[model samples]
Target: MNDITISNNPDRERFEVSVAGKVIGKAWYKAYDGDGQAERIFYHTVVNEEYAGQGLAGRLAKAALDETVAAGLGIVPVCPFIKSYITGHPEYEASTVAITPAHLQFLDKALAARA
Candidate 1:
């Protein structure tokens, strides 16, 4: 496995992926208060074009989601890539929350644009 380093840059509201100290990918999210609990809505994930097909996005997602769980925050995966990732990884299911209609609407537009 590659020595991919994942860190939450709360100052920037994103989780960054670095290899050899070079940033190559990031998963962005917005933090909100969900009924008195901290919640994170993952809106986007992007890996450098040159790093495509190397599964760095998956690594980023796993690290981000794990950190969210560790912090006791819920996850709302509005980003298609993140939704797909969590769907296929049952172990992370416990940390996920149901998407709201508003979030769904946003996701529809966001994902459609990507398609």
Candidate 2:
């Protein structure tokens, strides 16, 4: 497996990872209102089908989360996969904002719009 390069594409508000010049996965996230703070992150992530099960997505998510933490911002995962990732990784828990009813409402509407 080639080394993966992860970068924040601020213009696109997403984290992009490429291997051998081909994008293998990406995690989308942005600062948004979280209960009371505006700097809370709402993250969404995806891995290219061909790259799935190879841990590329997790790497991309980790890299992105690292950046957010460095920026001194907290995260609220709008992506189910990210939520799951956070579940098994308690180290990142302190940076996470619990998903509340308001967040759930937003996510529901978002899923519906995409459907």
* TM-score on alpha carbons, each prediction: 0.83, 0.79
Candidate 1: Cα lDDT at 61: 94
lDDT of each prediction vs. the true structure? 0.87, 0.77
How accurate locally is residue 77 in candidate 1, as Cα lDDT from 0 to 100?
90
Best by lDDT: 1
Task: Name the 10 consecutive residues with the lowest summed lDDT in model 2.
Answer: 35-44
TM-score of 2: 0.79
Best by TM-score: 1
Q: Model 2 off-target regions past 4 Å?
A: 35-40, 101-115
lDDT of 2 by residue, 1-115 (tens): 7567899888777889999877777787655676566544455688888888988888887888788878877888878888788888888899888777876776667557767
How far off is model 1, as Cα RMSD?
Answer: 4.3
